[model samples]
Target: MTAAHAPISAEPRRADFERWRRRSRLIRTLRVVLPAVIVLIFLGLIGSVAWSTFNAQPRAAQVGDEPIRLISPRFVGRDDKGRAFVLTAESAIRDRLDYQRVILKKPALVLDENGPDQMRINGADGVFHEQSGKLELSNGVRMEDAENAFTTAASLFDTKTGEVVGSGPIQGAGGLGEIQAQSYGVYGKGETMVFKGGVRTRLETKK
Candidate 1:
């Protein structure tokens, strides 16, 4: 007869099966809980980002009364006689106190545009009175045309009449030759020109 076989115990196998069931239950619970926790965290982050994005917008600024500013300004209108004229400036500003007055920098005025008697006057600084059609030219006033060129310390120009009057010293060169005077007046496209107060002329003739 063979040696008596040792008996196998079922307790060890049963314990192993019980441990496997417990582990399977724990794994299923964790699978569901982990994804739910991750989705909740993701949703919280999305909500926070959306809230911050909506709150980060710009606000409107304050407005002011003088809102107009210009560069290379140009003005075109008819004179009193219905002739055309133009005024240009490197910069211009309307007077806050007087709307009719305009301050000009490096101002240039062209009279009788494209006509036989075209004239141009310019200055470093000027004040144009729009209603009266008077321009106060100062700081190196200069006047020019086809035949004449004049310069003075200061002058007054009437755009309507095409007249330039200067009480300060005026010097110029023209068909009559180089002339100097304490004061001068030129009317309407130089149809008439007069000089007074220590007037002097030099004949510049080229042979």
Candidate 2:
């Protein structure tokens, strides 16, 4: 009975020792591997942030603050008498010093377009005053309507009141005749033409 009991007890003791050894070996391997994996993941995160920061520097440096430019600009408005007018230009450049002032190239203006008395004016260069609704045209300005056409050196036109005035030499040809004068004013939607300053007229005979 003692010999049988010894073998049974020894077998159970051996099995318990084997189980403890396997568990200890597994614990040791996990302890070393877990710390190594955690260090690798932390390094990967740091490297990603460093790469992103390096690539962003050039794009940040390339931005600029510059003045605005316009192409083929158009402005439309109504006059005091509810007459429509349109101001168009080949190109317009905004003034850097004054935001409301625009420098126009090949500026063209059309007034009372939908009405029976329409007027058109063209200039080589112009300056628009936004607040006053004033247009200053220069460099061979030409103005025309249904009955008359005139060329002047310079003119100031008020878009709101539909009033035009020029103080320089002007030459004109129209239904009445050809006239050359030093100054002129057009009012009442061009129903009236007043010329001043050394006025000369050549009337055409209507046969």
Candidate 3:
């Protein structure tokens, strides 16, 4: 009877001790794992931010709120008869991406008119620049105005003066005559053309 009474009292103490041991283990595990989880999350956030900074693309500069760019080869203008004028390139590159463009090469220009009226213009080996109101053709260039039925050479154009002046040799034919000169100047809106230096003209006679 005495042994049985002692065993019953020890059973409750053993159960209480087991419960306390489990609680202690749970607290210890949370204390160790919570800090480890927080550190891992902090490291992950740092790595993500660093990757975004290093791999990001730089922003392109803009001109007047409009991005500075070069246009691709395209039909930009029309002739008097409402025909299309196209730019023909030996090799053309077009990029509309993000409204930022870059172009290269001498592009030939073709007029909309037919036969002798159809013209082709090509610039010398150099970069062609397009400005606000006009196109600047430079570097040993040639223009075949088929409408006028002539091939002329020129370096610059003055829109106000309506003139084209050649920096080198120019040879061409018009409705009035055939011309050859060391330098040539043509009134863009008028028929008055002046050829200088070894100028020669062959007039077309009426039959």
User: Model 3, 79: alpha-carbon shift in Å?
Assistant: 6.2
lDDT of 3 by residue, 65-180 (tens): 44334344453555344445565455443333433222335756655446434555667432333332134455546765633544544455432333456657777677777888
> 176, model 2: CA deviation in Å?
1.3
Error of 2 at 141 (Å): 0.8
Global fold similarity of model 2 (TM-score): 0.68
Best by lDDT: 2
lDDT of 2 by residue, 1-207 (tens): 455543446888899999999999999999999999999999999999998988877666543323467899999998897889999999998777788899999999999886787999999999999889999999999999989999999999999999999999999898889999999999987888899999999999999
Q: Candidate 1: where are CA atoms >4 Å away?
A: 1-68, 205-207
Q: Give all TM-scores, in the order shown.
A: 0.65, 0.68, 0.46
- Which one wins by lDDT: 2 or 3? 2
Cα-based RMSD of candidate 2: 8.7
Of 1 and 3, which scores higher on lDDT?
A: 1
What is the alpha-carbon RMSD of candidate 1 to the true structure? 9.5
